[model samples]
Target: MLDKNVNLEGKNILVTGAAGFIGSNLVLELLKTLKSVNIVGIDSVNDYYDVKIKEWRLEELEKEAKTHKDSTWKFVKGNIADRGLIDSIFAKFKPAVVVNLAAQAGVRYSIINPDAYIEANIIGFYNILEACRHSYDNGEKGVEHLVYASSSSVYGTNKKVPYSTDDKVDNPVSLYAATKKSNELMAHAYSKLYNIPSTGLRFFTVYGPAGRPDMAYFGFTNKLIKGENIQIFNYGNCKRDFTYVDDIVEGIKHVMQSAPARKNGEDGLPIPPYAVYNIGNSNPENLLDFVTILQEELVRAEVLPRDYDFELHKKLVPMQQGDVPVTYADTTALERNFGFKPSTDLRTGLRKFAEWYKEFYKV
Candidate 1:
């Protein structure tokens, strides 16, 4: 079980993108478990979605700080691509574990604004690596683990039902997927050369309260609220492994302790201290089924009327370019290693999201 109490006393943790959905949740859990462990959370808090939501997440951090005054929870509002800013943070806090979740996250948006992905996903990640490289004095307990967020989008139309880390990820259809794949590759090289134990987590369709509004579920909700037709891509035939945000955080918390290691090189020699895992719900749900449940939950939560017109309010559109047919994650390795898998039913997770959306939007 991932709920086991793990002590991270005295470990200074650094979380980038701490304003984002999964990042904010992970920060909360870390504060809850590790008593007074210093955390330096960095987020650019750009207008990726509504900046107000990011502000709300920062407010959560503020609340956490008030509760644990001695926890040393600090937030730095700046872009990670700024080398001077990142280096200064590294010199000041000297975090022991670095979680990189800051990235320009959006598949369709990437096609429109590819430069944003390059700056944030590539350049920003490079600055983080460099900062980590300089953190240690003669390699004495600098960074114990460097965990980063990858995406199932890297699967790129893989014929396999459940994609694994061992699967070939060379065919990234979108620039966003390419950047995530590039992050894994870059982490491998840095881990091999600098001995920075790094782990990459491939998150699949994370959703719940305080989730990304840009995702399909949230977008559907927005469209439904205005009595607009919701576009069902691929004629509502796609299936996805929609892992809840809390479950994703739990997986990350469990993985924080299980750091990667160098492989035994040439009969007891060491390979790069890098690994990747898919943190996803094993149960894949159809897109239409997910929407139906979401709509039902909205009605239950009173966000939508008991008899809101859903029949004529749906448009079956063709799949967008760079869109995959389905996204499924093979969690056999994740279960075997972490002894945990995301088990939240799509209804259960989406219901919570519907409730939150209703409240947040005051609909």
Candidate 2:
């Protein structure tokens, strides 16, 4: 395993998209793990799905911060696309580690609202790259590592069984996928030009308690709760490497401590100090089986009645635009380098979500 080159304890860290599902869970993990660490978070808290969920996440963060007396948490309500705001935050906090999780995240929504994807995914990410590039001014010790979120959508419709980082991702089927691919390219350019140590994580279908509502698992739960039919896309033939949110956060925490090693090439210039990895369960579950497990878990959690007619609430539908048949991750490199891999079973993960949903919505 690679030696951890960066230590997070007693350091200033910035996490964008603080109120988000993965972002909030990450902040809580950092707070629980590190002492005397100061964290600055930024999120627009837009009403993309539900603002109350974002607000609840921030409230949980507040509670977590109070428990960890030595750690500090400061949240800024704004957008990362705001260049002035981003510059000022970097100047003020001077964070040693920056984690960028803010972006327009839905594949289907991207088709309907392409502008949102360009504005947040493209322009917002560009602003982040520019901020990281300028952080090293005046010979100051700028950002030691930059970790950002990428998606498995970048894999597109490749027939490969398991997607690997070394595989070419030049063909993106959706605008969302295209924008994420763009993020990887932009980070590579910044890393080569300014020598920023950056790593991009291609996450599979991440799901768990307090997750994004747009996700299939969560959306299915919502629809079932209201007796509405949940559409099963690809006629139940689609498969996904559904990863648990906690597992994803654990992968991120490990990556944060180990940035790509910076070195000079034969040409006496930087070697781009860049890397990318896939964090996923590696085991793809068929969509129909996934829904079955979700339904059983919902019943077990008392979120749904045991006698509820699940057959009446599920509808098999054709594949939607911007969707691929399967997504499987090849995590050999991640385990070889970090000695970690996601192992959470789907039933256990879905059970947690069902229980959390029951309590959160007072069902």
Candidate 3:
């Protein structure tokens, strides 16, 4: 249900990466809260993971839209890398609010395919900025807030426990992180030059039902199902603040309304309307304990049989390149502005994933 306090009625909001986990979820929430709000969502729907899951998310959104009294939702299958397509969509939609969740996600994958990152993250993001700058070109244009996704990877193996938005993020271990950091930089430049109200969200380990299968939980689940030994990195020594998708969606909704207004002497100042925040659980969980809890939940969800051999089917190895030791969020900025912070823990979030995976796969 939409929050009665928040009214996005009749506003045209564009959500890029609408077919991805967080994007699809955000689309649903926007529809419920706003009256007759037209949501135009775009996704390249590449084969990074199982494209089937992406297709399923779109189908689910279509079903939701079909039930609504008015057809306020439109899903476009295309790459953000396509400048012509991005410009055309902007010209037609003339969206008032733009949320960019469309990213070439995954840290390890970025290392393998450097070109994809350059193309999608760099080229694609530039196209978004260009289109957004010119979105109000004609007359009385309504491009207001532009929100894009950043990553916890920007912290880049910091010794700091709670990674704050104020901390220096100059060094990123992976190309993906580097690209995301570049995105923040690019958005900052656009916000300053074009006077676009841009907000970048640096999301921490987001996981939930219908989440990305490439994540550790999903990969581990798949391996466990096939009776293959799951490899534990860093000798099972790592920590993550697994945030629930719903919480992240709610945070975005709140930010959309407030829409960072430029001020003096602030990060978004001068280019004032630009801001960045860390949306995370703010509570880190040890990886070994996380796996144990996840296994228990999988059994409860019936994804795994009782008495599954847990001891023999696992191996702890050294950490991989582009991998971090731990991540926690200092959500002071988010809380100060939005009056809230993500608080979902690993067990609860994993349980949701286990249930959904069971139902989706009928395991």
Query: For residues 1-363, what per-residue lDDT tens digits would candidate 1 score against the true structure?
Result: 333223467788999999999889998888887767889899999997999999998898789878886687889999999999999998878888899999999999999999999999999999998887777767556777888999999999999878888899999999999999999999988887787888899999999998898999999889999999999999999998899998999999888887875466786645888889999997888999888999999999999999898988989999999899899999988898889888988889988998899888888
Best of the two (1, 3) by TM-score: 1
Model 3 Cα lDDT, one tens digit per residue, 1-363:
222232467888899999999999999887766658899999989998998898888989988887777548988989999999999998888888889999988999988999999988899999999998898676655578888999999999888778998889998999999999999999999887877888899998988888898899899999999999998899988888888999999998888876766555556546447889899988888888888998999999999999998889889999999999999999887887778877766778888899999999989
TM-score to true structure, per model: 0.96, 0.99, 0.95
For candidate 2, lDDT tens digit of each residue in 1-363? 988999999999999999999999999999998977999999999989999999999999999999987899999999998999999999999999999999989999998999989988999999999999999999989999999999999999998779999999999999999999999999999999999999999999999999999999999999999999999999999999999999999999999999999999999999999999999999999999999999999999999999999999889999999999999999999999999999999999999999999999999
* Quality of model 2 by C-alpha lDDT: 0.96
- Supply the global lDDT for candidate 3: 0.87
User: Total clashes, candidate 1?
Assistant: 4
How well does candidate 2 match the true structure in TM-score terms? 0.99
Where model 1 places Cα greater than 4 Å from the true spot, the runs are 1-7, 267-269
Residue 118 error, candidate 1, Å? 0.2
TM-score of 1: 0.96
- Residue 238, model 1, lDDT: 92
